[model samples]
Target chain A: MDCLRCAYCNICPIYRIEGWESVSPRGKIQLLDKKLSNRLVKDFYKCTVCGLCEVVCQSKLELTRIWEENRAKLVKSKKYMPAHKKIADAVLLYGNPYAAEQEARVLLNSPSNVLYFAGCMANFKVKNIAECTVKVLKLLGLEFKVAGKSEVCCGSTMLRTGFIDVAEKLFLKNVKNWQKMNVEKIITSCPGCYRTIKSNYPKIAEKKKIDFNFEVVHITQFLERELKKLDLKLGTVTYHDPCHLGRHSKVYEEPRNILKKIGYKIIEMERNRDFSICCGAGGGLRAQFPEISEKITLERILEAESTGAETLVTSCPFCVYQFSKVSRLKVRDVVEEVYSSMREVELKI
Target chain B: MYEFPNVRVEVDPEVCKLYRFDLLKVPKPFSAFIRTPLAVFQPENVKDLLEILKFAKKRNLPLIPRGAATSAYGGVVPLKRSLIVDMNRMKNFEVENGKLIAESGAVWFEIERKINKKGYALRVYPTSALVSTVGGWIAQNGYGIGSLAYGSIAENVEWLEVVDFEGLKKVSGDELKFYVGAYGTTGIIVKACVKLRKNNPLGVEAFETSIDKAVEKIDNAYHAAYKNAEKKIFLLAREDGESNDLGLKAWKERFFPLTGYKSTFSNFSEVIVPIESVVDFLSEVEKISKHYQVNFARGEATILIILQSRNILKALKIIKIAEKYNGRPFGTGIFFKRKDKDFWDFKKKIDPKDLLNPKKLKGNLILNFAGLIAWIA
Candidate 1:
């Protein structure tokens, strides 16, 4: 790609916070083009794969695809980072990237053809998001099954870091489990999982000659389709578009429309929609570069704070996790916001 | 023999390689390829920059001052095993009265956002404003976006703080003009005070018309718009595509659909000409495009022409046509064809060793030829 260096790096979180071109998208592309030694492998791992670079790219370089493919090539060359290796090992050993024993955090009250795939983050890390997701599903009066402990890591971290072999195994295992459940539809609250399962899974299935019959949808898309209206009013809040859900999956309007239906005033961050900044929690960045990830998260929080909104709402659990840790403003997942509003209506009765 | 500050110079090959090229948007000719710099020095503040400049002068090491490295003409490309002075870390900005006094590394978009909050905006900014540094803009003396009204960055600049072997000096007016478009050949621009105007959104109206009609309309409408308008009227015409007016509307609505057009190995030319000769200039552009079998269009102004073609020869032929029509290529440093011996003389006095961006004086002929050859090869 002929990089015009339009200076979109100015908006890139990793480049802005780290203050180095080596970690910037342009620098990474240069390194890839030169096919340099493993010395710059760490630099490639520094990106959050938030798709901000691709969105603002004047050349519209398929940067995300390049990054992922290069990352996979790096893994094949055995030049991948050790931190990413650890996450891959965890996924292989425990069926989850977190290496925790799988347990049903929220049990499904009734089994249905529709499966709620509460991803690794929602299942173990952010339990509230999983609970709220279930509550929202129930509030909408839809019979859905929680995959619970049956859900393996979607291998998003592994896939993003270039461990395609390991990710394929996890993808196969998840697909097998879904097939056994006989689920017709899969809904995920995590954008990372949503994107991987919806977009990435079919490719792997096609290659592996496996039948991946289930249709996948994010919680926002699911809720937008099922729920008629949310009557409660939420005060002015800013929406943070999770990188995967917004840019990766092209699901920008569903969450906003859901919020609008609830009578909430939405203020936009300067960087929103496809141009939305990352919470610095994706693409295995937080695991490999925690300090840089925290700095990026802080920047996103500051952007949210700039809007003077009382709350920051996001559709992805990972974004909520990152924003909640740093932002003074209340960070809520779209599901959590919907559930809370539903609960408020019940209390009024 | 001079000893550099321990934290200032980085000899790491990985780090140094990052500064080897700017965002020139074209492949370097095989012959023009330069080795990665021996080291990269990132200055955190003006004092650090001055010290580095002094050290580079003492050691007689060629130094290339870089800000965002977004120059389209390889102005920041390191031509030898030199020291690359990375100026992005020197970001410090403050507003005084109606002017912005900022360190060279201060990003244009960030400055725009900050000043915009105060009901003021930059008088002129590059199209790469999101990533271009204030110092780089001044150093390159760029003209873009708002130049139709405010003129080039050099015109909008109130003052500039530069440092070389001669130490620091704040120059304004005619002296400041020496640094504008000089690249870093004169001296390293450490900071600048740029003029600002009240932040008023310009009303953009797109018309579907041929290049001839568009040029005529812009000439008449621009005059009327400039009479009392806070912001200058800008126009864009798409030559061979679906209506760009709809595309512009989509962009304004923040739902930009990806267009199938990819500018691969395309030749682009931006030229400025007299306002009265806009129609004639456009006719010449059309003639060149037809002769070369390339696509050409006007953007925002009659003088500004954009040409896209996979054939490098056609693109080169178009550039020649622009020159024939008295159209000067627009860019920072030596990208433009302007010959100024006085500026070079002044540059020699300030940078006696020519340590700062020594390759800055090279014309676009070599660069364009290199792109053409690379594409053909």
Candidate 2:
């Protein structure tokens, strides 16, 4: 991971908030190179792992990996923040960071080829995203099964918070669960889960030499093809690219494709697509540093507001959860907007 | 033991490590030269800066005034245990009286954007304008995108408000030269009143031409000379709606140099030569290094030689190569202190205690020895 210290500081989200070099990717890399102890581990965690730095990085360093790997080292050495430890513990104990019952998380059990992986965020925190995703799936006449009690966490949170070993355990368990259920494709509403399963799982499977064979797709990627043109003029709406769905997985256009098909005018924020600012919900920042997290969230919210759009549509549950907390504009998962638009067409029909 | 409650100071060793170096990686043997500061301070206002300055004076601590830490030279890197005044937090700027008045820490891109909105444009801004602060650029006295039309950053400045051990003082004309490229060895530049021009619709045009011919045609045009991998000099100049793809690309990518390389990182150094000698200089270096980028603006050409490794010694070889073609290093910052005797004298008079970025204006033997090796190599 050669980091060209170009100091493109404007692209960094956390650095923008704290105005501290320690929080920037370049600064963290420099510190990491120095091999400093746990005193700066918290500064490393301050990032949203948005991959914004990587986009403009002259060295093209996989900065998110560097941040995550450093965090994993910290956790391994028992030097990570207590909040991160709590989330890791909650995931290990309850299969969800929210500490909800696994049985209660099993929303539906009807066996089907496609699995709707309503991630922990959708299931516990922002339930409406899951509901909207399910509603849209049903409206599209897609046969999908809920993972039921077999669906453990997708391990996005764990992987991001430096508990990769724990995340790998969850990844293996989920692979086994999906294999037993005989699902051919996995659709998730959370970008975190989408990225974790679609990107991280394959790597882990190869490492473990497990026969993990399930096609993973975010809800927007899945719905983009199935949704029809509504042409209902849903007014001007801005799309927020969740760090996981957009930069991490390169799924920038699928959600935008769906939004356009739904007949909504998409006015872009000054920062969009690969350059989109983080919603400050990912990378465990929302859980660990709530105030700093909210400050970042507010900045994004203000950017969304500046678009003068009626609704702020995003593809990820975490983005919706964070944006909804502070945004004055209506924050919605792309699935919700699609569901509402489909429902309106159904009423007209 | 010392504290200024009014300012944000970090004595945490871990955090201090983050400020140990600037954009330059300072590879290996040279890396050992940069010491982590004892404490880092973020001064929000002049009063806070004064307090931090006073505290440093009392403790006999050297003050490292830094803005964005964008310099590749070890300008911001502490030579010993020092107090770093991170000027980034002091960013505050406004357009006033047909000129832009900005705090030293104000980023150039931010200033440019704000001024552009008010129908004014900066006369010159560094290629790292997006991240580099005004004070930082001014400290380097950089020449960039608009430098051809407006000259070096020093030429466009109205005045500068610099803070020293005593208090804040406004310096302009002859006094400004001491601070412009002094690398903060004299005092911390708190604010600057920069000359601005009316915002015009900027377009670009590129053509292959000799460096001398390009210089002949670049009258009052915002120009940049880029010699591609093919050894063709493409002079990209600001025009009106006549941009070919190459011209637009060169203009669009003015900030990013030699980034198209497939490598994870690039090691580069900037050297200035006579505009007429740019072609020969680049041709000479190209024979050896094989990888270089030319940014010809103002009356000089800045050749950025992208090296193969992180070694500063290797980068210094380009400087030695540059000297053969009558070239000099762009910014004197600790690395080329010998080139600017006037700045060294000013540093002593302004900061008599040598408490302001010491060991910076004074070049050391080890670095000079490295230069000797580079010259021999």
Candidate 3:
């Protein structure tokens, strides 16, 4: 939608990382131009969408957002990432964004009363996070029930994969399910689903008058609010700023403070906060460009390793899954970060 | 030399600051400033530069005195913030004394021709004599290709006329001579009175030997000449194909073989002839190259003959006698443009000041000048 071709090509991370002008945001703009002009685009998936370009942009342009927007337009015009499209289709059909259904769901008071939606990653690849989430939330003495096989996709994977129209359809389906289930509060371990439910549910509700609403909270925010009551004794933990939670939503301080009360040291990386390097998993680029994403992820791990913390912590399940794949680093979900230090996880409800 | 008519002008200090930062970001733009004003305010002859200055003042702009922007460090604005006054336009020049009075805009090529016309050859203006303006060259301490022998631009200039944000002042050889290489911090240089060495009919012309042998033999030769001069004698080594990134490796391979030959491009590298101490330094270069991996081959060079006709025969005889040293005539370099190959386009691409601004050699601008000088015994 916007042009990124300007002289600020100097110090561009894509160019800096790759050591060439052809891979930078401006270069992508040129590639996009060629693709649009019927000149044929080459290496269409070289970008990892690390958001480093967004950091250097004086214009504050979300270049990745532009790519995703362009991708949607491309898909409409039949230029699509087939693998990505299949994943998004899975999210559309199954209750999970992954190709197959996952059986794990956490205990909440009711699916509607206080639904704990463990998004695809935590539900499948990172099932331990879901178990820890159930244990921790129940320790607070909250009423809960398990919807192990009945949970639906939060439409986050579809949105990221440029299936917004499909995402909206799924969103409406979730609204109908939540209204029928009478969900008063929805808690999600995934920032993607947390944001998708929070930002999109209201729009879907307004149109459909689903009339089933209360609060949608990320697990970090839920733990932060009940932190004093729960008396978390975890000491001094180093927290990794998950890209979606920290940069996308600006939820940085709550998780840090929660980790502190849990008695853990919070050591930071050289690049943190808004400038935090991507963990190499976003923008559907992992499927489209794995090496590009892997290098950025490796760099982020190296940054964490430099901190010398025993436990590397984060709040998103996807970040949890990605970090778990990195060797020699003690990567744990923020829920695990909280539950580990607790003499117990309260799963009584 | 061409006469440029005067134009109405005024000076401004503010706009000069902006011009100096075009495509460059400097905390202090003043260091890039040169005090030699090429935009002249003759107030008499050519007043266009003066008018331009006036226009700058009216527009609330600073006046920047620029030479060729080739110094390693920033030079366009030597002062904190200043306007750029380019003096490349002034051309009419004359050489009177060993000192030559030249317009600030006139480059070394024109000055060289005027001096040679009078049967006097200047030992100054070496590499920069081609494209460097007298004022800019002085500011940069530019050395001709024979820097090891003649020193830099500062060693070549005798005096200057400089204008500043304060007022116009005359700096001469009689004044502070060290200021020649100050790179316009003294002020905007508007004119220069340079010193020229007389041409000795019996001086040596050309010679070539291994860089090591030439370094050893050149010192003895420099001392033997009555006129007493020394110059760098070297040749460029070139090979085909830049695709393999062989610019440096290929040149180095001409004499010394490097271990790794798999580099994609030739990495075009050059052999440097530093100062009068070349003889003492050749071995050091070889050792350092071995230590640090510098790609260069030691080779012979053609020295310019600067002696009389009678001695010219003797110089040629010595060159022939030195044939055992492995020496030969080096033809001119061949360069093909990457794009835009027009007759005049080639000339436009050359920096015309390459030797003076050695940095320009990699680019499209090189300036050349040559002429005849006659003397009666």
Candidate 4:
């Protein structure tokens, strides 16, 4: 391993706050070394696996993969962090991290070609993107069923943050639910939900006898396919690229094109696309380390401010919810584009 | 000299974009002090300084002098081959009858802002010209975007004043047409007087035309009107990229007359092309863009053109003709013009020292070494 002589972590915000190697890249690397070199069972599952170091590192090393590789090694050694184990167990028992899984369900009973998988965010936050997406679908004149809160956690949050056994159990449970619904395609807005259902499920389902023949789509890809009708209108706004939605999944332009069509003047922030700043609400920080997470959220807000934007818009409900926590600026999900048409306005000049 | 451990040293590690923050990279030893000599020597005033060059000569200690950290191309940094004598601390500015006098250390932003608020303009201005000290701009023969009309730094400068490392004195005026943008090849620019405009000229912009027609119209129209309305006009074309549909383009068109002006690039990306090959390159782009679905006047390829004259109508006519030639026009803008001053330093050769940044970009020479200075080994 190459040595970082600057040792930026000497003053790394997260490492300083936490005071642990597991939270720092250098420490994480050392832990990985011990787990790989020494035969001891390292508790590798506790990390939030946030890519903050990747954001700050001058060398631009991929630190998240370091977290994942160590997790895989811990799995081999049969070691786990308590918090992740509890989360994995909860997801296995209930279909989501939340206890209200069954009550969150609302099946798509209508004749629809598209299944709107609202994921955990909309299940709890509901109105942010859910209602707006349905309105947009109706405007496009395409048939879509609101899985209303009915869709089980695509089991994405469980798979990530290292709860492998529980994640595997969730994969088995959700596959049966998906099959029962005659699901052909699953479209979700959450990056965590999108990535988990799209990438992680296939890995776990490889040995299952469940012959689920369907495709998983993020709402962004789905929206790009239906942008002609989104002819929804808009004004000047900055789009926040969520970490899961951006650096993780590499989906950048679909939403910008959508905003453009709706007549909104898109004000691009300086750090955009792959280099997008994090909302600080992801990778378990929201629950495990609330203060640090909020700092990241504010940091993203500061980035939006640099653009002199009139509004902050994003595709994920998580971003919408996190952004709303700030009283300083205006924030919205793509759903607001739909909700606006229902209102009438007269400027008092 | 005390023996020391090995370490790479470079002067001017920070590349200035006129912004306060710096982009620094440690490189070979000489790069650091090649331009900013005062960084090492915390000496007293200039009373004792002329004695040093002679003293250094006896001991063979090479001397390097530099202006403010304002050279656009890293021109003001000291050479590692010698001792540095940074001249930023020297301040000498005089104002009279719309004319301003400056020492080597005087900066553009301070003077321009002061003159601008008072409704006046400088004699010469480069893009980075404002940030650079008077001595630095003159020595480098700097060029600004108003290049076509002003014809680079050499054309705008009116006079010069210099002091060689050996205390030699040289003075020139606009009548002689001395070296500018020459990067201090001459002596140190101690004090120089520059020409100034009676009116304040701050930068303002508006959209005009879209395509080659934009260029053609602006060029022809400006020339057509120049007889009666000769005014200095500054123009820059860009690649703003194709809007998704007619409405977006139409919106842009509504804002600026889209018929003559078009764009083919995104906002804020740079276009610094070789001059001799530009016209031919523009012509080829004009013909081939049709198949690529670039219907806008300024798609994929755009050019920057500056027109100068006192007549404003000359500029308007050029805009009209630019419209006829298929240009996606934005709008017109106003800028305060600063007349060029004689750069006494570019003419006098101190030395062309190699000051290299340690972290070089792709395909760059990391070691730009020179043989003048006795460095700490």
Candidate 5:
């Protein structure tokens, strides 16, 4: 694709705030085409892999795939940012990037064929999202078991940061654990985990020559199918599209459909669907450049704030966590919002 | 070693290579004219820009000023190993007394948005407004969607702050005209004060018609709207019916497609004529296209008679026909045939060394030669 340098890609959250061509998507592509220097390597980590660039791309270039591949090349050459190394170490040592202790495994060994992989974020950083997913699954009367402590990092961060070997190991371990459970379906509230398991894991498994089974579905997709089961009356709320769920996976409609069925008035942000901005927490951005990450997050919150919606609903736990940090408006996972509304209606009945 | 005050100089071969071309829609042979810059510079303010100019002048290196690089012609394309001064970092916008005071690099769309929030809008803007910078429009002497109502950027601009090797000077009236369409030959426009209108709703009407009927239909529509004394009417005609939908989408998004089939090399001609001569000029274009066996499309696309041909000779023939009908190439840059002798004389006086965008002074001989080669090869 010809880079017109039209500055249409200037709307990127990181590029908009940083105001440097070196950090912009078009700039990075130029840098990659020429050669990757230490500065270019540092700039690559600045991207959150939001996929906004790909969506707005007039050439429809596979920018996300290109970025990921370049990142892998950088990692192979040992030219990656130090923060990525720290995350890799933490994931390897603790089975999570957060470096929390791995308590006794909470494998229920239930006879249920469904499994809820809460991921690392939902497990520790945003536990309410996990509990809410469990409660909603129970409310639906579906037999499902939580991965609990047994679930390792889905290796999304490792893969995104170019630690392919580390990601492969984690992928194999997670697949083996799930195979032991004999599950037919896996549901995740975290878009990172859902995207990795549903998309990236298959590629990794094929490379390792491992047979992987079990259908992977995000909670939004699962809840969308079971939307008729719940009775809810949610207030006017704006929905934030998680980059992983909306752009990477093309799961835009399910979350919006679920919100509409729950009786909430969906006030759309100016940038929605494929054009939605990132919540500034994905692709190891929050880990490597927290200050830049916060600025991007603030910009997103302001966009949501402009909608005048009292509540901001999303399907991904990472987006909820990031927005909740700086947003005055209530930030919630779609499952949590629906579950609470369902419980309220039950009490009223 | 080169040094400038408060400016970041990038000599990275990778980054410097990207500045080699603007949005020039020419065939591959013509692309050979694009020359890579020796280095790229980002100046933060007028002071930095002045210092860079001085530095370039002392060394006698060609200095090319770039903003957004959205020029349909090779306005910002360097002629040799020049210093490309990217002006995007100097985006400072302020509004006072119904006037927009913006730095040259301030994006036109961003300025429109800011002023819109304050209940004001720009008098005129280019179709490429989303990515086109205020400085670029001034340099290119642009006219677009609202030109029929507000005239060109030259008419809308009130004052300009221009920097040359000598120093900075405030130019207006005739002096400002030198910079418009001069393609940065005289000096660099660092800041501009443009007239703003009250944010008024524009009534847009789209219709489908054969190329034969397009010019008359659009002219009659404009007259009819004028008779009604409607605030303003923006008329756009596209030869491809399918493109109308794409145009509408672009209008809604307020952005031009950055990359697409349109970005490919082609023989594209944009000609502007007096309202009375538009029909005649378009008919002539149609005749030439048929004679040359060129796959041509003609219509009133964005207040100009745009004739596109797949064949290079056919495109050149159409441009020649447009001149016969008293039409001039639209926009002020390398694409157009006519030169403003007065502007050139003024540019000679100010930029005596002609070290800024020296390619603008080179006649269309190179383009003509390339077009001939393209037809043969």
Candidate 6:
């Protein structure tokens, strides 16, 4: 709450587009400080929850958490956007925010020590990410279970949009399912899902007096270790850090390492790693404010294109989907890059 | 409520409240006097600014021109219930002919980054440059990070396009003194063209020395400032790899003065003392509070003293001590109005109606009594 009112509004993706202080991180904090929940609910939700403000913050305010907790408070006050309400409703109704049929879920029901949580986005929206991830895992000789139909939403969108109670329910369900399956480790391609299960789930579980033993990780973290760097040239490509993975989970170098190991010369966008520009698909922004989200996505896409890299590679499926929508440049998940590299080596043989 | 079809205007109580204050945290006891702005307006261009001025003239409402609101001088704080002209949306800049021509709301760091790509750098920028706006630095005290070598922003500025009640006109040379660091009382700075230098990589070094010796070491360096009250000099020069990790850390942290100390104190005051008097001035500051810092410039040291326990008395005592050393509080915004008579004359000439950022460059009852309160205490 000790916002110095420095107004570092330029760094914010939402504020950069909206050009309003009310939508900036500092302004939202001030609004919350003043207890203007009615105004805070609308303005705060405009954010993509990218921790750029935190990265540039002199105060080092944990601004993403502040936004989330404030959104939770606003939700308790029954003051939230209808879009956020729709997300809560969908998560409750379909066990996932996408409202996809249980039959459409690609469940690898085999018993294994590892569970590949494809998240809601990979399962429904971008199915190739999950399929490629499965192929990559199989190629690496790892026996893992994909929580397809049985998988509950990791409660990332729910937590971000301030449906913590609903998110907790889903989290508990998923944790219980993984525990029953004797899952020791969970890996996911979705940064949102990875961050939630790896970071938020344990915290929430502790608060609720529930315990689950599973090592959660993003696919990049898993692939960077398991997938050996083959002798192949994959050409130059730029990496876009998913906000949930880079700033939220601190999984920056793993993705870059994975890319470098796959034989692609990484031409970094000017804003890369912790300082990376968000892909504008996280924190329920793409689901709620598609136009602003797309504009932000376009900004990142422009930055990526400026690098002159042939492909825009990222680990998050949401980033892939969002960038694919507006970006003319090629977008691929890091797993897809690895899968392509593996296939290319096979073709060479 | 003020309105322009192209401009964004907000009268929401919550939004206005956010614009009501700046970096200055007026304690609860005295904060009641600071009024929430009637409205906040974001004008995107010069045309919108003129329209807002015309509307303000008609309404007889004073417009507080605000940049990043990084200054703690109450320059952007609306003393009387008035409209806030948020200048951030007008951010547009270009580097041409070895100068950066920028809208007043363009961030200093952003402009520096833009020019750095073109192998040009700002002559002087506030240490708060990361968040401070060009107009904010120009409007308030602009002697900061690079001022050790380049002097104040006044010396570096080529011209400023200002819009007062009269009309739009470019002011430079002696006229800039009336507007630059006048806290927007003279006129609203729409755009400015400032001098730039070659973007040379600066190396930093830490020196443990006396106050005067450290100030002496700052001669012709890119930047030299006291890292803390411990008299450790964090000096930046044109040389390569002349610093340790602490010096590099200090160099990196120049933009983050408000970081890591948000809860340390309730309020702070910026004071400027002659280079000769820094030793005495700092000694006096040490007597009162250990939470103070000094940034050395060409011939002066800008000192920031955290007021102990949010005590107005202690803050006033520090100001009185600074005056003894022939120093004055930085920026004449609602607090220190002793200097800058030319600003008063210019305000009378340009904004006789005082429609542009009123209640600054002058004091209210509470501020006027600060000295007396200090003396009595």
By the lDDT metric, which is better: model 1 or model 3?
A: 1
Q: Give the worst 10-residue stretch by lDDT in candidate 3 chain B.
A: B367-376
User: How well does each candidate superpose onto the true structure, as a TM-score?
Assistant: 0.90, 0.93, 0.48, 0.46, 0.83, 0.94
lDDT of 4 at A77: 62
State the interface C-alpha RMSD of candidate 6. 2.5
lDDT tens readout by residue for model 1, A63-130: 89999999998889888888899999998999887888887545574568888888888888889999
Off by over 4 Å in 2: A33-37, A103-106, A109-111, B25-33, B113-120, B204-220, B227-239, B244-252, B262-266, B309-314, B338-346
Structure candidate 6, residue pairs in collision: none
Candidate 3 is scored at a TM of 0.48
Residue-wise lDDT of candidate 4 within A10-36, one digit each (tens)?
A: 123354333323344544544445523
Off by over 4 Å in 3: A1-15, A20-22, A30-34, A37-52, A62-64, A102-112, A201-214, A229-236, A344-349, B1-377
Which stretches in model 1 have alpha-carbon errors above 4 Å?
A1-10, A33-35, A109-111, B1-8, B25-33, B219-263, B287-316, B332-338, B362-377
Clashing pairs in 5: none
lDDT of each structure? 0.73, 0.81, 0.51, 0.49, 0.73, 0.80
Q: What TM-score applies to chain A of candidate 5?
A: 0.95
How many residue pairs clash in model 2? 0
Better of 1 and 4 by TM-score: 1
The collision pairs in model 1 are B235-B300
lDDT of 4 by residue, B176-270 (tens): 34334334434455666777665523222223333333334332110110000121222322122222342233332221111122232111101
Arranged by TM-score with the best first, the candidates are: 6, 2, 1, 5, 3, 4
What is the DockQ for all candidates, taken in turn? 0.52, 0.48, 0.01, 0.02, 0.37, 0.56
True contacts kept of 4: 0.00
Cα lDDT for residue A107, candidate 5? 42
B321-343, model 6: which lDDT tens digit per residue? 88899988876677766355666
Q: How do the candidates rank by DockQ, highest first? A: 6, 1, 2, 5, 4, 3
Report the backbone clash tally of model 6.
0
Q: Return the DockQ of model 3.
A: 0.01
| Model 4 C-alpha RMSD to native | 15.9
